[model samples]
Target: MDAPTGEQLSIRNRDAHAVVTTIGATLRAYEVDGVAYLETFGADEAAPMGSGAVLVPWPNRVAGAVWTHAGERHRLEVTEPARGNASHGLVRREPWTVTAHDADSVSLAVVVEGREGWPFSFRATITYALGDRGLTVTHGLHNLGDHPMPFGVGTHPYPRPGHADPDDCVLRLAATTHLPLDPESMVPTGGPVPITGHDFAAGTPLRDVDLDDAFGGCVPGPDGLVRHSLRGPRGGVELWADPVFGWVQVFTPHAFPGRAGRAVAIEPMTCPPDALNSGIDLLELAPACTWTAAWGLTPLA
Candidate 1:
């Protein structure tokens, strides 16, 4: 047999089941009634295509893997060699501490110590729970250092409706504005721009469209939540987040592990990509202050 994923934890209720790994506190699997909602890989392998990885301290890319803070330029290790940018955040590959677990819920924590380039220590926690609504995830962060910390958070989950080929799925997003990107650097050019054929404000079929874009100007509903959805023939999946999550990234990669053709990644973000450099919607947590945000997924029949 293949080796087990490092320290996997299983949680389930009558409504759903989920597998979480301590490594990166990644969501290894999530299914309802034996139907997979999130594309999953073997436990022995690392997260594929950034599946279920939590991006903290920052999300998406940091252009040139460098940013300026408080008048000092800091360089980060290049995690994305192709673009020479620092992709994702700090803890995706790091082992996290399991603080709590039960039949329907599990919580993991990690500490990020301030290094030379990224200066400032902080503690972060991610909690996952299964319920009738599917899976809910909460991210929390507390600044431990004396100086203020500029940070952002995001989650990468390639959600799919069972049995329906991703190419045929219909995606609907509540966002109105798109963050235009520079073709080469993939960094935002300026403010939000009008969305064209790529728009999902109504509902758009996932037919042949290649997308790796960030969106803002979300039109939240009555409960102060933004909703994005993917619907196929068998069923559908919906991702909703608190208003603090003003940005959502829609990525459709050509091929995904453990899948046939393509996959859709609907990511929720507290800020736009390269926010560290632009200072756009980035959260600044003061010393000893705490920041919290909630997001979840629900299976649609």
Candidate 2:
């Protein structure tokens, strides 16, 4: 029998590290040291880390969001009221079918129904793997229908320095450009601007700054991984990404549900807010096209 709804959580562990993945791309884990750091961010509201896990039909914020697919105009349902466009796609809250499962990993697939707003159909897979140090998440997309699919993929994880105070942590972001926002609705107003105090190129102490924005043009490691980190007094956590994640959104929610200010979200995305309306970096995948992106976390000694 299929594992019970919530009981289907995959448990992966290696030495002192462990990871948990719900059948629906919800990755939550209680580290050995008692830190409940979420490797994948969508499960519960109060305990939710990533509000929307995978971005599809497009990424980031879209306004009234009009798109042309297969010679027809498509308009997505507005997930963001203020912006009047679909925020993330339908995969976040939908039930995903379990494809692969094991001790250290699990794969889940979600079928995105194409409607007037999103007229192209696609199948998305999310894989969670645990290594000796941290977790590696892979997103795979395959066009299930004949029509071309225009979309993007992203990952959201809330990392915490187990049992450490967040205010005392230092945050290092690998971003060189930031999107300026509209004052009234907080939507993207113009193009990318040089980062100033808003910049975290040199690693900014978390306490010294406060922000919620999209950033890009970061330096990648030899492994071709773009990393952002939050360091607590004892240990730190890293959020790794790839060139596919052209933009990273750093969110420090002091009013977070579970642990208050001890949480920070390093989000990986292919585009910035409102990609559909802006028509910037939008990917129109040929039929049966597939793409992948990886991000993980490891404790720093």
Candidate 3:
């Protein structure tokens, strides 16, 4: 296998330590003491299944790999070939440059230039910081082009309860509605539907439950952040995001490389899948405008 690319940045505070890779600006590993809170792969291996990847401009799949803006239809490269659609965005696998670094945080930036499918240019920065709250990740984007642009942002971080089996974990979300997807394309079929199973609004166990669904209508707490948690026998971990991130994509894969059984990926999204086509919760950035979103993980002992 080929070696991983770019620099590996480590940031630590009194509470936790995190490993961030310049390639895709991904979070390779995050742990408290020696136990890992985020799912991790070998250092030499590529980001497994978009684990800890930052999805930008758009988060999920785009149907037919096409979208229209300003009366112009753009055809994106189909990254999800099996589903006949474009998966994620362009930045997930790209390299980023270090802008600044400190003892507890590192900031990296990347630019998306004009291309056949995406004709707009923009710059984005991701900062990973360690604090008492565990780890806080901030993402910022600026429109470099002279016109308005539609955009969205998200991050893929698989949370593992300190080596606990995912099958025994209890998952909970503050979301009230869930998006149902078409079996073939794996795209949203219609609108948000009522949530069911394990009472996600309350708490649910991972026992025999299989999910690859996007949920919306997240009810943020008094602290102005939406939260999701995975609790195991010993302890738990919580994922929180700013109110700007109104959607969360929950995916539980049957087996992930290097790790078996269920692995959970709780993605905080500014928009749902195919938002480029549906125009649902899509953000429009004016010329020279910048937008930012924040999300983090906290350990619950």
Candidate 4:
């Protein structure tokens, strides 16, 4: 197991479950039964750990990993090699501080100051509620700075299907359009792809396709929430996310760092790729405003 790097790591557990809360508003760990549905970096790993939670924020992605704000332009250090975009927000690099902790829930907060291309300040909170089925995560962001803040919130939850083989797993999305990408840098060309390799309009089987693309135009459910889900073969386990999560990026890494290898990453987001420059319907909070979202998981099959 990789030792957590932050100084404020807090571990909580109940029965067969566990939650690792990092000051970074990160659900560093969510475990159910003896199996870890989430991925975590383990021994002999060179990439990152798995089976934990991570937070995302701020102008999610900018063209060329660069952005210009109010006569000022800043270039973010690129974290995504393919597109040269910043990819996930800045919270991933900073440690969140714990706000509250209990038997089953944990809350963390982080303040984002104008850095790189952004020109505002805000405080973000992420709360993870771990239960028997799995976990439900909630996020809240408040603009505390004088200037307006451009922001979006996201979380990376690595879940493990109880089954031994991935061949029995299926991932689904409710998106209607996908952001076309430039092969050289994975940044959006601002064009729409017909949802072919990245399409799951009809709930395609996970085994049939490989993906790492962002899609929008999702159909919101009766509750006014857009949703996405994944199921393991024997129908034993599943996960569902809220509709505010407008875009879903599905990643099937060829050889996951942990476990027996292959794993699927179903990431839900509030906006599509290049939302910063595109001015897409990103979850931006004005000065003194807050934005929030939630999702849950269960097991059956």
**What overall lDDT goes with each candidate model?**
0.89, 0.67, 0.89, 0.64
| lDDT by residue (tens digit), candidate 4, 1-301 | 4335354344445543544545344444445556655666632322253234454564235668887666677778777766667867777657678878877777888887767655677787877777655677787889887777666666666556665455566666778888876667666877655566544655566675676677777787786766565666544344566777777766677676545767776667777667777767765567777777787655444
The global Cα lDDT (0 to 1) of model 4 is: 0.64
Candidate 1 contains a number of clashing pairs equal to 0
* Maximum-TM-score candidate: 3
Score every model by TM-score.
0.96, 0.87, 0.97, 0.85
Displacement of the residue 113 alpha carbon in candidate 4, Å: 1.9
Clashes of each: 0, 3, 0, 24
lDDT (10s digit) by residue, model 2, range 1-301: 4332243354557543443444345555635445545523333332264542555545566656665555667776777776675776666655677788788777888887656576667888887777765777788888877876767666566677665667887888877898887745556888888887644766677884666778877768788878888777777777777766778887777766645554677878887777666666667677877877677777665
lDDT of 3 at 156: 95
> Stretches of candidate 3 above 4 Å error?
none
Judging by lDDT, tell me the better candidate of 2 and 3: 3
The sequence of per-residue lDDT tens digits that candidate 1 reaches over residues 95-151 is 899999988999999999966479889999999998767799999999999999999
Between candidates 1 and 4, the one scoring higher on TM-score is 1
For model 3, residues 1-301, the per-residue Cα lDDT tens digits are 4448457888988757899999899998899987789888877888888899999889989998999888889999999999989888989888899998999999999999975599889998999999878899999999999989899999999988885677888999988888889989999899888887659867899888888899999999998999999998877889999998999999999988888777899999999999998988999888899998899998777
